[model samples]
Target chain A: MSEHGTTLNIEKFGSASEAKALSAEADDWTLIIRPQTGWFDLHLADLWRYRDLVTMFVRRDFVSFYKQTVLGPLWFVLQPLLTTLTFTIIFGNLAKISTDGLPKILFYMSGITAWNYFGECLTKTSDTFNANASIFGKVYFPRLSVPISIVISNLIKFAIQFGLFLVFYFYFLFRGSNIQPNSMLLMLPVLLLLMAGLGLGSGIIVSSLTTRYRDLRFLVQFGTQLLMYSTPVIFPLSSIPEQYRWIMIANPMTPLIETFRYAFLGTGTVSWGMLGYSAVATLVIMTVGILLFNRVEKTFMDTV
Target chain B: MSETVIQVRDLSKRYRLGVIGGRRLVDDINSSMARLLGRQDPLAKVDLLPGADKQKAARSDEMWALQNVSFDVEKGAVIGIIGRNGAGKSTLLKILSRVTAPTTGEVRVKGRIASLLEVGTGFHPELTGRENVFLNGAIYGMTKAEIRDRFDEIVEFSGFEKYIDTPVKRYSSGMWVRLAFAVAAHLDPEILIVDEVLAVGDAAFQERCLGKMEKVAGDGRTVLLVSHNMSTIQQICKECIMLKNGSIHKVGAPGSVVSEYLSETRVATNVDLTQWQDRTGNGFAKLSRMAFLNADGEEAGIFPIGTTICFDLETTYNRELIDPLFEVIIHDPAGEPLMHLRSEHDGLRIGKVNGRTSVRARVDNVGLYPGRYFVSARIAAGGRNVDFPRLCGSFQVTPSPGRHGDLRLNPKWGKYHLDSTWTRGDQ
Candidate 1:
């Protein structure tokens, strides 16, 4: 709202009079920082106002990943690649988990690529409170910009890893390796959303809890690793006995990974009711996560 | 009508003591279990405030860092918040900046605010100076285009142009602070809040920063400056708020408020270092007392110009010291370093003070311009700082009324007036 400074005369900022006009109309939107709010309160408009900060945070995360390394962005590609190869051997060849006649590489790579997106998001957003306490202690920005940026930056990593999976998919297709296409493949975007929403929700919850008890941090890392087993990343859901299959289906992540596998590999189960349940559960967790996150962001500085 | 850029009402902050604020799982479980069994929680309460009432304070662990403190700021006012350590200056800034919420009360602001509570924060060591400028700018809420528009100016101001593309990790810590402050100085927010962390910058850079702050203040942006340097605050700020024990003690022109701050609550001056209770160094040695001596070997609070001004540091050693070194730093009233006298610098190793011992340092022909000056004392055994009081005590170098010639000292012109023979002949 300061239009008189020479700073506004800078070319990219447009005219000082424009800021005057804007401030004149925005008279009633004064931001009042209060001590308390309802658990669900969020300054979404303020977050929108700090969009530049979100972009900057994302850019920082993107560029600072591979400093001093010979292979920078290549790590994005190699992480899922190495994990997929390891899964193909440890579970596919050794334990003999069925991929329902789908190519082992294709089946396992998709799962890792899909789940890794959520795991990366979870890990980064979980550290949002602890890692940024110094900066948070100094300046005031919409704190949510931090966790949101983690999700956006992890989205970029997911896209690159997803592209690597695509290359292998086409290579197997040329080799006629029985990787089939089905109408369910169109469900990929929805499945991706469920993954992101679930990841962000659980992440902020853990992050919020860790501000009080740091013991949750160790649990978060171990929990994310253990969660993959419950979600069927290595083995398809059909490989399990029907009586025990319900245990995997009970996990909020199972239906998402299962559906992703079903859509691409055309060999796994997909239930409309289970998908609905996953979406509903994700919504509930997300609401709870955001409420707890907002509560913690208010005074975490003192405790942190 | 002119706007009130920031307004606050009944602001307060409470913090718990005896814990790191990280409550362990066991503690949480024990508390919950007590609640379930209808028993009282062991960590029920404690008074954490610096000055709290006796009976209630005895029962609670919570500290009220700020208590019912409130003030309003008119648009474009350059106000200084001055306080000693633990006076809640930083906490008040944190609340105003919305970095943390108050335990009670509310703050309303009418414009975008940019605050820097710490210097060189958010600077990635691996990022280049160019990238960090943009990165830190954006972190402060400036858009990329804004940083791009001002990139040349930033690079030039930081004087890192020759190495702009090089990674910041290679830059010295001072260069990093310069770059960070350069980016923060250019913020175009409607309200600017700055903390004393700028003290980290060298004197020249700090001068430039104050000049820039003055220009920004003139540009009609409200500025709230916090610092322990009374002179710097008085130089730039028209009005000041002096905080005492977490409340506003006075709000008036900088001159009166600063004098009030100086006279009544000078932290530790002339106190024998041994009895200086706010020490954080190991218990091996204590600065017992600081003695200001005149030419007659008697204690003196005032000295004439061109005289040897001597101060004796009496330190009581709890443990035997090795190669014990003493250091004294004198600063002008403006908080600028005028001299650093170190026993080690003089190639003298005064060893092993088993008990009460004294070291004396003298500035011969104390050609200092006649004005106010203060000294900070330090003792380092081996290489670690032992007893370093920021302000040991203040003294006046009163001008001799009939003093003339090259010795006609002008305190306003410079801090020191060294002895030199003037030869004004044609040669």
Candidate 2:
């Protein structure tokens, strides 16, 4: 057999002194696996090395979502359009909640577009462990890649919905509505980044917790809904009473939605202070989420 | 000079027994709070608590899947890990692959390591074969550029070029396994950790996988293989490690280590088979005991060649069985079936059996080669298997004088001996 020929070559390595000499240089080892690592050891370089896996996961999520479906990516536009219509009818027209002087459809559509991105990212990433127990159980990659890919893939959906919002946005501007667009529109990318960060941060926290406490899986479904009301998604932040403003601002998602409307429709209140606070909150939450996620990932296979 | 690519030191992994989520969340919160406050864990056993009982706590909720196992593997060494069920074979592979973490100790590894704990680890059914190849490749730690460069070769190796664009869900099970194994086969890591993945697909594909592994080993890359199939272990591994009950039982050349493992697995005569949990079937009937008997109807551990060997199986049925068929399959030392003796094949089907029954299959003038052999017993009725206990018992076959009066029968000739008359034939 061919194996015997190879076996002969292997047997020649009988020099113990050489192996011992080489092993003395322990620093030459590339990877050291242990039971526990420091809490802050995020292994970001490993994550960077596995960036292609993130991209592949993103492509899988994006391509597989629309396969064999009649509408395909049109659903990306339709989803927010339908949700905006429902909000405009139920809240704007029927309930008579003020839209801060902007057109009811544009106001609701803008809020729905931004909220949908955060909502999708949050809900999808929150279930990363449960949804991927099969793959995670068998293979080892940076577990954060799954949640990071979710945030990115949802960005594509958010972009499509943002384009649809822009259609009506320009139509209203050409119609000479009182609405005004201003330089705050430059904060668009930063606003998306803040939203993505908050969603990813909070989502991973819930996912890490649900590895043991599965009740959070059920809580996340309604938790995102409750969080939406606290944020200025359907109503303008100005509608809140002065005493309750801090509560709304404390939601972290508030300034993102407020800045989105203020930038595009030039209606909702936008403050640099609140936006900075939102960004800091995102950073803090992201740090804690990553640390907790890193800690849980090592032994979640046992508990999960 | 050889360099150690993988050095594992005092590795141990502990798993909590019982339902994973059975612990109350209150207990978890308490433990975390205690840990944060620099206090002893409230739920910790008394034995672990200072000033508590010196006696060991009844920590029945904990199990050590692996315990203080240490070994080193040189560069380019093909190492095989063999063990029975619950022997920590998969646990070791999982730790090496980083799929799970150990409870203690450490493993230091050099070079790029890719582990194929199972084939098709992250295959998305909605994705086409081509997309899955890239996805599965990335999951195995390959870059998109690397997969792109080897995409044609991967598809060619899988022999699924025509179906590359077709969604993997539409492919048959064999095709899917082929594509998955194809991507795995192309992973050119410096150290490859494989766990029983060669048992997939058909024989030809398995041969291809073994060939690929041999080539990988020949490339001066290290490989760690975990498999239950002894022949595959003996054929591929230069060195073998046998684990028993989460500890290393033996480490040596494949031949001696494998024989030691086989000899240890040879159950004593009249072993209580009912306690064998690693069995498969509907459980309508169970084999309670199995004994190897000589021609004198006495329990025997050794049977000389060309003698009557009887396999006595004691079974208990839950209900009355109709037309039950019993089978005794003799396997060689390498765990490959050497002979299959089925009741139906011999036209000795029993009409009916009640509660407890003793079945016997006797063969006259057995011609098996002189070696250790394992017996797998099975009971079937009503067109389905009632019980199948694999490798449940074993016995020794010693060489004896053949019809031609040869004292020594060389096992290298074959697994069995045949009495043939040789005459001068007109050519």
Candidate 3:
């Protein structure tokens, strides 16, 4: 058994050295709570220990979202399908926007498939604090579990949407429509990681800010919609004016969508340098987001 | 040699008062700019400005929820934290549970800590009982394998095995509370922090919860509990901490600490109700003052058993009121209503009342046990509440020799005493 000796030191005051000396014998203490922790106090070990909670949250979200609905998980496939059809009609046919000689339906479906995952992760994770405030107020769990679970749960929906895209891609291929499947298609996992990273990174940053300034919630709602226009989701990046192409390239999501289309449809822009830049940007945002989120999680209970 | 399972040193938590969103972004920017320029905060409180005469800012916007509270919990000890509302009991528990960080000082804890600030912290209404059990268990930091091992025991304990597959939203509110409490009861952490979760469910369930808690305490885990129920605290806790105005007022054996707390609360009851802000009603009429009177109409604060007691309420109204029902409810120290006295129930009819009227309800024999009881008064007219004030005032009941002769009445028997006659029947 560990030592059970009682130590009383109520008279000691304003002595940082004594406190440090006590804390330095840290192997005996399972946890030491203080007023302010460093920015990098991410508590990754605690997060790992609470990984089951993250899985449970993901399960609850997936099961409860489609509980009574007749369509159920079918909505996951239908959502992207309907969105792709609408984009095909408005942006491709009516607006006279070129799909770079690829089939409009397949081109839009490919981009939508990739964009939907990032969009869902960003929008849902951004509301992590507000949506789970009641549970957060009552219990002490890794607050990051909620957003991380959201990203994972949305992956299931992404899979369903990706399967739908594959069905259409094969149908066009067997019909002799001009589409190429190439080695670049192996970048699918890396591209997915980049999207998840960018989404989670910016999502938590906004979630942390929203705890104090509620006005940011409204901004996030429309901000995602405005952001999709900058990416190559509805339109091809190659069609933009040469001088003005940098505007679209500035968005981290731009290269991700462009590369996803080029890999599958073999018609959109894909550059190693741009993809590398997007990867670097994701890393930076993720680091900043996690740090800000850690800082806010400790004290947001009071403000939120 | 008892181990100190938890040590809290100079722990304090400061909360900013007023609306959390009261300050605009412009004010935040201006303050940051001023701070960056090595000047005082531009938007700080007037007293906190550069030229303030006070040694400390003492900003009115700030309030310390917990101030310099230090204590240690030995393993196998059940410690009860008792205080009035806003006395910082919850804040102390919150800090210890890590729901929020303290503003200063530190707390070092050994072993795993599971805090049940509420019974069903993460119970989703749409999930089935069985699913929620696993979910709630995981939320309490239990793994899936651990939950699976004890899932049967949990289901049987909740007495919801038949309804285990049904969604929680479909269950009755009582069933939901039972299921939630069952999950909480099975948490076997080294340190258990509970905050008034025993107040939920029915009386029998509360008893079962207390029994479970006793078993937990008996298992030699460190338990920290916050509750207003003095009896439970005194019965379960070997030691008690009394909090007053965000600081520890006393810490000792449960019996003495509870009595001290009760005595202090007795003195804190307000006699004048006009300025009491904690009230709810439509506000057509208001209760101003309350006085306890004896049989001879003499003002008194204490009355012995079997004696006539009257509660006189001084009331005021802005306009004439008709057929107003005057009601008074007596509650025990735990805020549980023991008796209700209503004019309508007694068939008393008051035709009309104007501004500044007094109402009195007289009891022929005050059969209450000897202890302090609070009064909640309400005046209703035309199917609507004119005024309602809860715990407006308190009075004491003293023990007296009744038909039982020299045996004093024990409050543990119950809150009321009934007149009875015993006789031998011829066979």
Candidate 4:
């Protein structure tokens, strides 16, 4: 431990107001910075000092968006509900995409619900610097708190949407829509965690890059759109042709979507090998993302 | 006794001027592919040396924002950081506030810190002022309960009672600044750092903020303030640090540091305005130059408070134009306008001229704060035109022998300076 040196002897005199009045009366104004060797450096105490500020920023991100809307918190549920309806109409009915003979709404809703969480997190994380540069420039809090808050706030939205899926799932079961809860459903939390980790990880990585080239900004939207095709979002994993099955299975999201559908409908394929692969991929990507994010947050202002 | 809460050791931050570094998707893919084959990084085979600069045009040139800087801040000490533009004062404060990290060296500190590098900085424009206050407070590290406790005070301090529910985007710039400052000052933190935010808001608000900062510091908290206003800095800060370029030029007693800063960056009395090449507007009704003539009618460098003065402006009108409006705006050294003089309402035309024209304005008395000031003159061929070349020059106003604070006008028993007298009569 370092020994403390150069303690300032603060003479407890009067109230701050009294001191201010006395200073004004004395008519002596001064600006002082102690000449030393370590002014422009990182200070953890500063970040700890501003922890409350980080929390406030997190709350702001969470609450401000839905404050004025008519549906209010219900908007969260409505988002995935509407998206699930669209996917059911497009993939289940028109395209005749197979859901392994499960209820159309239930199959598509489960996939969309999980997929939406990842998409939202990734998109939000990718735009972190560009979206909040003005705020970041003006105040000093933990820079990571911004992206971290984005993930947390989006989690709340995901929870609400997920709850809506649950409600609809029970409705379909009650209506005899060929759905039954399975043992795989118990792993829902783990699958959701994987989705969040991968989305947040990739989002922050791209966000760090988008601050510089901005070319990635366009690619993020395009790539997300293309990446959706590779995942088992619309069609079941079994629908892929035999030769291309390995390529589809190689996607990190494949196990999440498959396990999610298998949990509720008990029809889609679920494999421990695929889940383990995704877990490894999630860990690797998250490590890379955090390292890159930590490095970028230090000097992104220069490039951004 | 106040303990040294923050210790920085040989900290320096260097930034690339125009470049990019780090891995791209291709790099990541290639690295992963190489690792699959048990090989070294593919790009490492090319630019393996530390000084290698020929690899890419993206990651070459750089500049140092903070170089070899060091300091220790004792708890409860209100230190002011000051410098001219681009002196790295903000950068130093930002680093201390932990918004960014230094490229070299380390910092050790104790306790919580909240920095308002800018007012209303973290505000979401779409959110109401009420929502923003909570959000901004949270960002500053306040708990929801803490924000709730201080919520009323923040709102009342801003004096935006009726507009609290309004989205911050709709609030005036003044309201925005006041609200932002209120949130920052009210956050109960062990260390508070602010950067030149006092320049916002009216005089009374600035005074109130200074008082609040004093109160915070008095409560055994550390404060780091960066501002250009010497008087404000001197009033609020006990010690001062003067930065030049990217390093500390001087530090210690605020009075001495401020004086040194002023002397080093001060514009010479005999400054030639003609050499400034950045003046806007073309030669068409262009203002070539401007100067301040003293009470003795001699061209002078400095003005005293409440001195009668004349502004001599030379303009080159290239087109045959009708009535042209000529105006002169006087701004304090910090770029705050003190007064603006214009040909009242109608345009003052030096009609149909293709040659140079000189104009003059005689004022009874010019009252201004004791500091350097800038004179920006404009000559528009017609009313409501600002694109024409305007004359802009800066001048200094030395503090009067007996005067104080920002405003120069002396008043007699009035709330504001309005050139009036008050008498106590039977109410």
Indicate the worst ten consecutive residues by lDDT in candidate 2 chain B. Answer: B49-58
Candidate 1 lDDT over B1-427, as tens digits, reads 4455676667777775644568887788998899999999875653355454543244356666776676767788899999767788999998888888888877778888888887667898888898888878887878888999999998888887899999899999888888888898878788889887776666677778888888999998889999877767877898898877677777788999887887654433355555555455666788878878777777776778777677798888888898888888888765667889998877876765688888888777776776567778888887787767766677767676434443565433566765556687997
First chain TM-score in every candidate? 0.88, 0.93, 0.92, 0.81
DockQ-based ranking, best first? 2, 3, 1, 4
Off by over 4 Å in 2: A1-16, B18-58, B279-285, B294-296, B300-309, B318-353, B363-426
For model 3, what is the C-alpha lDDT against the true structure? Answer: 0.85
Highest-DockQ candidate: 2
Per-residue error at A209 for model 2, in Å? 1.1
lDDT tens per residue, model 2, B187-242: 98999998886676655777788889989999999999998767678778999988
**Which scores better on lDDT, 1 or 3?**
3
- How do the predictions measure up, each by TM-score? 0.88, 0.88, 0.92, 0.79
Candidate with more favorable, higher lDDT: 2 or 3: 2
Q: What is the C-alpha RMSD of each candidate to the true structure, in Å?
A: 6.8, 5.8, 5.0, 8.7
TM-score, cand. 4 vs. native: 0.79
Per-residue lDDT tens digits for candidate 1, residues A1-304, read: 0111111111112234654564576555377878867775788787887898888788788888876568999999988889889989988999888888889999999899999988988988998899999898888778888888999998999999999999998899889887677888888888888888998999999999999998888888889999988988888888889999889988889999888877777778889999999999999988998999999898888886
* Cα lDDT of model 4 by residue, B1-427, tens digit: 3455655566666666534443356666787899999999675433223553232212345555666667767778888889877778877877776666677766656677677777666678878899898887777667778889989988888888899999888988888888888888787878788777666777777777888988998998989888877777777899888777667777788999888877764444333445555456544656666667788888766676667678887766567666666788876555666777887543454556667677778765555555556666777665545323322466656655533445543321212233345688998
lDDT of 3 by residue, B305-362 (tens): 8898888888898788898999999997667898999989989788888888887899
Per-residue lDDT of A175 in model 4: 88
A1-304: candidate 2 lDDT, tens digit per residue:
0111111111213466776777676678898999978897788999999999999999999999999578999999998888888999999889999999999999989998999999999999999988998788788999999999999999999989999999999999999998889999999999999999999999999898888877778889899999999998999999999999999999999999999999888888888999999999999999999998898888888875
Query: How well is each residue in A114-142 modelled by candidate 4, as lDDT tens digits?
Result: 88888888998889888887767666566
Q: Is candidate 1 or candidate 2 better by DockQ?
A: 2
